[model samples]
Each structure stands twice: as C-alpha cells, then as structure tokens.
Target: MDCEKQTTEYKSLLKIRTGDKGFKDLSVTCVALANAQGGRIFIGYDDKKKAPLPEQHVTPDEVNEAVTKLRSLCFNVGLVASEICTDDTGSQYFIVSVSPSMHSVATTSDGRIYIRVADKCEPVRSEDLQRLGEEKGAYQWELVRTKYLLDGVALDALRQLANDIRKSSRVRQHVKQMDDVELAENYHLVDEGYLTNLGVLWLGTAKQRSSICYPATVQYIVYDVLERKVRKEEWHDNRLNPKELLLDIEQKAVELTYSYEFPNGLFRKQIRHYHPKLVRELLVNALAHKSYTISSDIMIKVFSDRLEISNPGGLPLGITKDNILHAKHRRNPNMIELLSALEMMEGEGSGYDLIYELNAMEAKNPPMIESSYNEVTVIQNAEIIDTELLPLLDFVLQNYQLTQKAFTAFGIIAREKKVFSTRLSAILQLQEEDRLRSYTDKLLKDNIIGRNGAKKGTQFFVNPQLIKNAKVNLKTTLKTVEPYVLRTLIMEDLRAHPKSKISEIGGRLPEIDLQELRKMIYSMVDVELITEGARTDRRYALK
Candidate 1:
C-alpha cells in the first residue's frame, strides 16, 4: 500500500521469510504500533516489492514461529487475530494484527519503548512516553474501585439518580426497569461489589466525595471586563452528580446574565448574556472529557464580555482544536454513555457542533478554542453582533438542514454584514477553496446567501428576500477583530496598530522572544499573508 502517511490509524508491515534478520526482533515494531494505534504484520510478503515472496512456499513453521516470538517479545500488546490469505496465484501470507493497548503502553522485550508517527515507528522517551501512558490511563481509572463499596453510596443520591434516569426519556425502557444495583452496575458506576471512581463521584456522600481516589476540583469564577476575579464558587463537594453540576452552573450563569430583548412576529424574544443550553452542553462536556488523573479543577471563568470554560487536560490522543469541530473521541466513554442515557448529551459527541450552531443562530462570535499540554479552554465571546437577524436565523433553523460548518459560514456573513470569500475561507480555517463548497453550496443553491463579484472581490451575504421579510435593516459593521496572534496571538496587534515593526509587536507580547518573533514575522511574510515596509525599518501589516 502507499505509505506516505498511515492509511488509517492502523498500518501493515511485511516480512518475507521467518529466517530473515528482519524477523528476529520484529516485536519492537509490533509493540510500538500497539503503543500508538495498532497495525498488522504480513508474513511471507516483501516490504520493498509490495508482494508475496516468489520462493516462499506455504509455511506453518513461520506462522507458529511468528506467533511464539511475538508472544514472548511484546507485553501489554494483544495479538488480536491472525489469518492466512492467498493471492490470485495462491501465494500465501500470514497476517498478525496487534490491537492498541487499552490502559497502558506497550514495550519491547529489552524495555525499549517506541510509538508510531506516520509510516515510521520512532522511540518515545521520558515525558513523551509518560504522556502516552496518561493518554491511555483514563480507561483504567474510570472503572477502578475506589476506597468505597456499593454500601458506601449515599442512599438519597442513589434514589435521586434512579429517579433521574427513570424520568429521562432518552434512557431505554429496559434500562429504566433495572433495580438500583442493576442500574448502577449497568452504568458502570458500581463494579465487582464496590463503588467505582465514577460511582463514588456520582453517588457517594459529600464527605466520601471530598475524599475520593483522586483530588479533583470544579470552580466557577466570575471576572469583570478587566479580567479581575470578582466572585468564586467551588464544587469539590460532589454532592451533586455530573448532571446536577451542569444545571447548577447553567442556572448561576443565567442569574448573573444580562439580556437583549426584542419583538419577533407576535412574541418578544430574549437573548441572554450566555446561552443556558450552551453552558450546560459545555459544562457536561467538561465533566465528561476532563482527565481525572490531572489534579486540576474544571474551571468556568465568566468574564463581563466572554466565558472561558477550561478543563484540566489537553485533548485526547488524536483530537486537536482544528478537527475538534467534527472529530469525536471520548477520553471517558463511561461518562459519555451514562450521560447519554440521562439525555445530558448535546448530540452524539457533537457538543462543539451544537456550540457553533447556537452561537451562529445568536449572531455571536464563533467559540474561540485554546488547547495545550496542560489544559483545554473554550472562550465564548458574549457580544451579539446582529439582533435584527434573529428572526431570519429562526426561519433558517426551522427551514434548512445545515452542517456545522455551513451554519458557521452563514453566521460569519450574516454577522460581518459582508465578507470576501477568500477571507471567509481563511477565517473558517479551511486550506482549500474546493472543500468550502460543501459549506456554502447549499446556501448559494437555496438563495439563502448571494455571491457577488468574483475572485478576491467576491462577497457573500444573506438573501435579500429573507432580509426584507425579517426587515432586518442590517447595519454595515466592520468585521469582528480576532485576537489571534501568529498561529494564535498578534492578529489583534496588527489590526489595532497597522504596519507595526517587530519591536512594536514585541512590546505587546513580551513573553515571545524578539529573535523568534522576527523569524516568525518573516516566515508569515514568506507565505505572503503579511506585507513588510522598508528593509532598513521593517514594519508589518496583514496582507
């Protein structure tokens, strides 16, 4: 197969003959692949020729040897299955598939650890390996029994949970029919006659929760426009389960909220400072995805103008912010499954999509996401750009089926008043104009949005008919300034102070070194995204 990048998260390697030197210590590659995603090994096949060996005949010895060697060599890596397949000419190859390690890292016989990166297997050492192990660790911790047993579960809380599940329409009839222990066991809250880590967090007494297997915290901090902390609340008590925490946090946000009210048809519409649904969805996700191993709080920092909901861990193994809008990977599947049973999910791992959809409908700024090795934070700006378009948005939501990206693109044009196609593409983080068709084609086809001019001059806007129907009278507002600089910082600086030199930008972001900043400036300029002034005195601005 073509091997520039892995075709899937999996890969396949070839071994022509068992006696070949390549066969002696093959478990290194096997273990590495298991530690990462997982791959298959094809015996009696040649990696160089991409075909079965010409001279190699049917060999039961090779299959047995390969199996025995792999069993003896790799630990914590499962040889999931094996099969022998034949080509058109009846040439046989033995396939040995290694499954990804669930809760730990796999290592070679000699204690050497390696991880797959693309088509190659590379050694991972020290902190990188530690991070790898932690990536796989949530599965183990979620089901592990804490110091508590089923009897330790608070009776009131257990009764409360049973009632909640029974009340939830999302839960199945059979699931709702289960007794208390059966319900807890079915949800993985109770295991092997004991309260699991999740069970303790969900049903344990306040005192039991405050003293669980892990020292965890949940904080809701309020801030003014200046970013100074005004008020704070902590929820390590865990008296409330995940669902209860979601409601309490959402309610508090509503209590502190300011709102914009207007007429829509016969009824008055009210848009709060924070969307309560979005708040619950974001918080529910934070509760589900947070790394329990990381001894940090799931923090909701509410600013006068925005909200930053931060959880302890970065994204899971294969998730990044760019793909987070569509890619779904759950660090804690048990939490997700249980939450789904209670109808606490926004959609099937589509919370980000819902966040985007809700923001778009409200004409609010698209949620800004920040992720790093230690934390993942979602920043939702509270300002509404267009109040008049709410009626139009309501019409669209009621009428059309838009993908997450389509709604976001529509929102951008509607909020910005007018947006150039290329610039819109960039803001959407799309690298190819062709891919953008999927988001805008329907809008263009339905005449929901009109495209004018061509190429760089092309502008997209909401349909005149719809705007007229709603009597939107949209104001011609400047584009919302993104505070992104370089990869994520500096855009605000350039927008606020056009044609700024490195020194000027440096003054604003003192944390980044001047030389490194200079290099980055030139690199961005090389892509023709930024323009530079005189060589003797370089000043830069967005191109």
Candidate 2:
C-alpha cells in the first residue's frame, strides 16, 4: 500500500486486528476528522514507514462490519471508503476519508465529542463547546432566560431608554406611544412574563445588574510606555447598560486627546490626535459585539502613539480579518438591533469602512486588526505627521473620482514626492507592474503628476500646480501629446522590463486603445526606436 506521514489531511491507524475498543477509538478519530478539515485515514498501515513484516491483514468482511457500525453513529458525518487492496507483498489495507461537516459538530456513537487539534484528536471542553454552539447560532445568550423577574426591572431605566429611542431619527414614531411592556416586547427583550438576558442588559434595575453571573464591563487603561506602567488614572466599571457604558467610555476618551493648530492666513484649523467620530464608532463595535457569556471585560489601552481596543470574543460567526471590510456578522444581534434603532450604530458593517476612509483621508497608517483564540484587538495609530500631503489627500478623498487602488497610488506619490512607477505597484502589493497604469495614467493625463529621468530610472513626481488648485482638462486628444509622451512611456516600459509582450505594454497604458497601440508600435518600429520579435513568439524590445 502507498503511504504518507500523518498531517492535517492524513492519518493512519493500525486497526486490522480490531476489537470493541479499537472500533470505538476509530469512530472517535473519524468524528474529529469530520469536525476539522476532511482527511483520509489508513487502516492496516503503520503510521511510520516500516520494513515489510508479516501483514496482520483483516478480511473484507471485517472491514464491512466496522463500516456498518460507523454508519449509525451520532451524526451523519460524510464518509467514503476505498475497497481493500493488496500490496506487492500481499499485505492488505483500506482507507476511509471523512469530509468536513458543513454546519454541525460530529460526535461518537456513545455521545463523546472531539475535534482535531494539530495532529491529535482532543475532547471538546465546556467553554469551547459553548463557543462552537454560538458559532453555529444554536445558542444566543441574549435570548436565554434570566433569573430577574419583570417586576424587578427598573421602571426609571425603561422610561429613559424609551425616551432615548423615541428621539432617534431612525426609530418609528409609533414607538413613542408604546408603554414599557410594549417597548420591551418590540425590542425582543421580553418573551411572555420573563425578562430575557437582553432585557436585563438594557433596562434592568441597578440591583438586578449586581446579581448577574457574568457582568458586562469595560476596563480602561492609559499606559505610559516609557515608564512601562499604567498611568495615574486606571479604572474598571461594570456598566450593564450599553448606552451609558458607551457614553462613559467616550467621556474617558475625551481626556486622552491632544490638539494641534494649522494656521492659514487669518484662519486656523484644529486637529485632534485622533478623530472623535471614528473613536466612537470603534467603541460601538466593541460594546455591541462582545461575547456576553464570557466573564472578561472589554479592554481599552491608550498609548503614546496608538490606541488599542479589545473585546472578549474573536470575530463574529463567518467573519475574518481579511473580509472585515465587507462582511457583516454581529454576535449580539439583539444588542446590535437596539443600537441601530437608536442611531448609535451607523449603517451595518460601515464602521470599518469609515475607519479606513478616515485613515486614508488623514494620510495616516491604516488600523490594524488582530485575532486570537478568544479575543479580537484593533489598534489605531494616532499620529498624523504627513503635514505636506495631508491637505492633498483630504481634497482627493473629498472631490476626486478615483478607484480604491488609484486613490492608494495617488496617496503614495503625494506622500513620497517622487517614486518609480514600479514602486507604486509594490506598495499596492500587486505582482505585475502593468496593472498600475490603470491608476497612474489618469493622474498623468490630468497633469497631476509628471515624469522625470528616463527608461528604468524614471521617477514620477506629483505636480505642484495640482496642489495649487489648477484645473485639469483631460479630454484633449493624444495627437496633442502622443508622439513624444507615448514613445517615452513605451521606452520606459522596455527599460524596466527588457522583453515585454505587446499585451503587457498595453496594460501599462490602459488609456490607449489596442488598435491605437498597434499603430504606435509600428510607427516606433518605423523610426527604429523599438523592434517586434518574430510572430511565433511575439515580444517587443528597445532597438
């Protein structure tokens, strides 16, 4: 039998001589493989390569009996088996491949649950199981019943929340006429006479907040990095009311700001270390999505140059850091709905988008998001030191029509003063330099940027006239600037890449049509400035 070492996708078991215990063990291993990414398991083969020993081969009948028993296990895990086959030495083995479960965790026949951790299978712990349940949306802490009774809910708190909701522009006018009980029902905070966990979190009395098993709180810390210790004022508050908790955090953050002034003639503009609106959006996310089942408090760390906020939960179900900008998954849907109705949360999933745009407009580094087993932390850098290009970026974001990539390329050149066209491609992390012209050429034709040097040493500099508000007319025909400029652009392409195809050259000048590109190439060949290789393997190069 062909064999390979055990890995995430492969495992081997020596169960040819099977018994009850061996079959149960094999069943548990199959459950784990199904929970994780699907993998193949070999039954009569040694985990490690071995010298041919007398094969303890099992008959097909025995393997078929084990497969029959596995079919009736706790969960219908996707499994397929290979027919028994003999090796060169007459040693027989069979393999079973388990596919990953789409939406459920697999379990053994006797009700034991396990998941693959590295190369081994381990039993799922209670906390991890709860997390998995949450991931599957099988359990919602907010929807769970709380011990607090309806009479125990604070009347004043409910009135205040009702008034707050009524004042929000997003809320319906009819909500203003509903009584406290009706209001709670409208928000899914109450079912029958029982106040759910969601109800207690929002409208519970002060006494009710103290009786919860795991109280929701925020821990605020301002660190002095040079001293390597928490600053003078550090505190923790257990505020069960999400609205009040958000307000308190915002007040605390106000103390952390420092301002600078930019003077222009008789007028002056004030800039804070970080934008308050952006900070509030981040706070709303941490408060609305934190796991209520965990005992941990939301953490806020303010440093000299950056601010970090973390909550006691990784990303919501189906959301990862790579897709955070476009993916919307809220762990506490109840809380998120309430917050959105109150106008506290902006459009769904727009927080990260706002953060990215704010950073780009300010010419600041983009925020960083990191996740671990039980937490997600976002670090926002506070410095806005790109004084020269800050105004330009602001204007571009506010007035210019540019795609995301094009805007990014514009920002890079405006900040760096001058860079090779390839450098912009590198900054964008694109593998091919040709894709960059789709962005840079727009700025070039508008005269917002001008080229310097020649060939491979070429550098692009942002035009000072553009910074001075000089209007650009980009509709002029290429015949006005085509002869010298187009030829130089092609020569620059050849100098950077000695042997490039015509299609690649066209990619670098996306503004020019394919027919126009062919005419230009032939015209350059006529002038002996460039040459095309044989038709069978067509490529262009500087003559």
Tens-place lDDT per residue, model 2, 1-543, is: 344422233323444345566767777878876765456777666556632335656677867776776666647477777898676778776778777664677888878888665567779898788766765578788887776667644566777888888888887778868887799888877778677888887878656665664557777777786736465333344444888878766776654566667764489877776787778888889888888777787888888888889998766644646557656777788888899988888757677766765666666766788865468899988887476566666666677777665666676676555666666555554556676687678777767677765544456766767766833222333322435787787888788986777788888776554554675677777464555567756777888
Tens digit per residue, CA lDDT, model 1, 177-214: 99988898998888877888888888887777777645
lDDT of model 1 at position 264: 65
Candidate no. 2 TM-score:
0.62
User: In model 1, which regions exceed 4 Å deviation?
Assistant: 1-131, 137-139, 152-156, 254-256, 261-269, 394-406, 417-438, 452-459, 476-543
Deviation from native of the Cα of residue 148 in model 1, angstroms: 2.4
Which residue pairs in candidate 1 collide?
Answer: 484-489, 485-488, 485-489, 485-490
Model 1 TM:
0.63
Q: Candidate 2: minimum summed lDDT over ten consecutive residues — where?
A: 471-480
| Model 1 residue 425 CA deviation in Å | 5.3
